[model samples]
Target: MAGSFFRVACQDCENEQVVFGKAASEVNCAVCGTTIARPTGGDAEFTGSVVETVEAR
Candidate 1:
């Protein structure tokens, strides 16, 4: 499956981020150090609000 990018907002700091859909490592918020996404074998499991999806055209 083709991977995409997701625009997410941190739950604690409200910081916006662009994370990999299938991130192989933990993704944290730059502003608050909050755990935003975690590796789940395939795609990254997000713990923040999904602001939008970014796909390559």
Candidate 2:
């Protein structure tokens, strides 16, 4: 199965960004550089609020 993408809103800057569900590296906010997602060996752990889930097409 393929992993999905997520639209996350940063808590500090409220910047929205798309992140991979199985991200290998840490995902940061574009505006503030806040840690939004972290790799957990499988699905990434999100620190910010998830605005939407993007399905793979």
Candidate 3:
């Protein structure tokens, strides 16, 4: 199984960003610098709303 990517909308600034499902580090919003995703042991925990799941090609 391969890791997936997601389009997340930031709650604070509404910045849309693509994040890795199995991110090894914390992901922050580009516009507002807010914490968007946190790295868990396996998958990342998204703090913002998930707009869509990006298909890996």
Candidate 4:
């Protein structure tokens, strides 16, 4: 709800974070703080035509 970012499923807490940018690539979970999949050139991952948001509140 702040800026354009990427959400990675926390391996523990299952929360999302805005760890993405034009140069920013790798991201850690906002809940668990675990390293998620490194996006290609800060690109967001998608599931077919829908973007996958593997995060939990």
**Model 2: CA > 4 A from native:** none
Lowest lDDT sum, 10 consecutive residues, model 3, at 48-57
lDDT of 4 by residue, 20-53 (tens): 4332455555556566645555454421121343
TM-score of each: 0.91, 0.92, 0.92, 0.37
Cand. 3 TM to true fold? 0.92
RMSD vs true structure, all candidates: 1.6, 1.4, 1.5, 7.3
Clashes of 4: 0
lDDT of each: 0.92, 0.93, 0.93, 0.45
* Worst lDDT 10-window in candidate 2: 48-57
Residue ranges of candidate 1 with Cα displaced over 4 Å:
none
Q: In model 2, state the lDDT of residue 24.
A: 96
TM-score, candidate number 4: 0.37
Please give, for residues 15-51, the per-residue lDDT of candidate 2 as tens digits.
9999999999999999999999999999999999999
Per-residue lDDT over 5-38 for candidate 1, one digit per residue giving the tens place of the 0 to 100 score = 9999999989999998999999999998999999
